[model samples]
Target: MKLFFILFFLLVLSVVPAYSYLDPGAGSMLAQLIMGGVAGLVVLFKLYWGKFKSLFVKTDSTTPEKDNSSQTE
Candidate 1:
């Protein structure tokens, strides 16, 4: 295992040669996609905020003793 790891490390370190080019249009498209995803998440949360809040909240009916005091006996 040590020999294999050493060889792999050497192999990874020995190679380096390549210039990459990115067009301006591609960068703008990537930015738009990121912004759109964030906007969609915001809209989704707004639509489901009530349901999300309910997950962490305890309703009075779940524990009947609290409401029992309010009723006439």
Candidate 2:
């Protein structure tokens, strides 16, 4: 766990200069915008993935639940 944390921190730190020399021209700005949009989509998906998945899940409602199978003494 400690090693994982250290590696994660190092990976995060290593991305600091990824765009340090990128020019702020139109092309670069557009590229950054697209990257940011993709990142935003990824984060949004992570945030709502559970709800999204539940939307597609098939609930087994056809079979009535057995209420007296276990509760009866």
Candidate 3:
């Protein structure tokens, strides 16, 4: 499974062209890097989102009862 994934990734990367003439200015490079980083982060978060949400989710059966008692006697 791991080998297959690596091979698939390498195949995809091979198809992508290296930095071309269009990315000439610093601004363009920065923009591309930012967009790429954001896209990668989204993919990463999506992959782990289920586990991340489950981290905060309650799974226990017992629910704490609400306290309605007033401080004033």
**Which of the two, 1 or 3, has more lDDT?**
1
Residues 11-49, candidate 1: write the lDDT tens digits.
Answer: 586363432233336546644543567664455445357
Residues 1-73, candidate 3: write the lDDT tens digits: 6545644664574464444323247446544543566564455445357556867996652332223222211
Task: Estimate the Cα RMSD of every predicted model relative to the unseen true structure.
Answer: 23.9, 20.3, 18.8
Give the number of the best model, judged by TM-score: 1
Q: Which model scores highest in lDDT?
A: 1
Q: Taking the tens digit of each residue's C-alpha lDDT, what string does model 2 give over 1-73?
A: 6545634654574443332222337445544543566564455345357556756997663343345334432
TM-score of 3: 0.22
Candidate 1, residue 5: Cα displacement in angstroms equals 36
Q: Scored by CA lDDT, what does every candidate get? A: 0.50, 0.48, 0.47
For each candidate in turn, the TM-score is 0.23, 0.21, 0.22
RMSD of 3: 18.8
Weakest 10 consecutive residues of candidate 2 by summed lDDT: 15-24
